[model samples]
Target: MDKVLEGLKYAAAGAGGLFAYLFGAWDALIIALVIFVVADYITGIAKAATQGKLSSAVGFKGLLKKVMIFVLVMVGTVVDKAIPAANHAIRSAVIMFYIANEGLSILENAGELGLPLPKTLKSALEKMKDEKPEDVPAEEQE
Candidate 1:
């Protein structure tokens, strides 16, 4: 029992533990975000192939941006750690922001592939997508 507890403590000092701790979303958020990521990537690839502009560089950049969404999740975690009361709000907002962005990208990818998309979700995502950046004003830009 003592050995196991010590091992657990040390394991968390490494990247593998950190990755899980940081990226492991709650049950609902986990399902939704994982689905969002996979669907968005697949749709993006389809869009690229259809447009005859499939470059690995562009795809990689897109992947990096997607990865940054999770990085932002870690940002929320850090914020929560710093300010405990804001934990729930920060986590929800971060998840919502990424979900909205991913949802928008999925819609864009669909349009790029000439598929008809629902207007309402696209518009909602547009609004949600715009809100986050605007909330951080010029003074905070530094």
Candidate 2:
């Protein structure tokens, strides 16, 4: 059993290393995105459970979507690498965008679960959700 556990640990580390390589460094942005993604999924499940609407198929779909988020980030990393001038810009942008999106989903789930959010925070999130990339100021886009 100990040997098996050791083997599993090694395999997990190998997989993580490959993931980090493909994603272009496991930095704070990626970490925040992961946290938000997981939190959104958990809150989604909780909200579904409260409403008695849980379905295995829907849950599986959600998992697929979550996985695809990382897949997209990997693609972003590839794009950044291909463009020598990009300097991880594409990957960082993709991660940040997903972090914000997942955060909004989590907040929405919280609201559905009857959790009271601060008025200012809720309004700010709502405003962010409404804003398009083009709507952001040129200086802030950097």
Best by lDDT: 2
lDDT of 2: 0.83
lDDT of 2 at 26: 79
Q: Report per-prediction Cα RMSD to one decimal.
A: 6.0, 6.1
Which stretches of candidate 1 lie above 4 Å from their native place?
A: 1-20, 130-142
Quick one: best TM-score, which candidate?
A: 2
Candidate 1, residues 4-121: lDDT per residue as tens digits?
9989878866766666567544457756877888899889889889889889998898788778777887788777767877845686678777777788888878887788999998
Model 1: residue 21 alpha-carbon error in angstroms? 3.2
Clashes in predicted model 1: 0
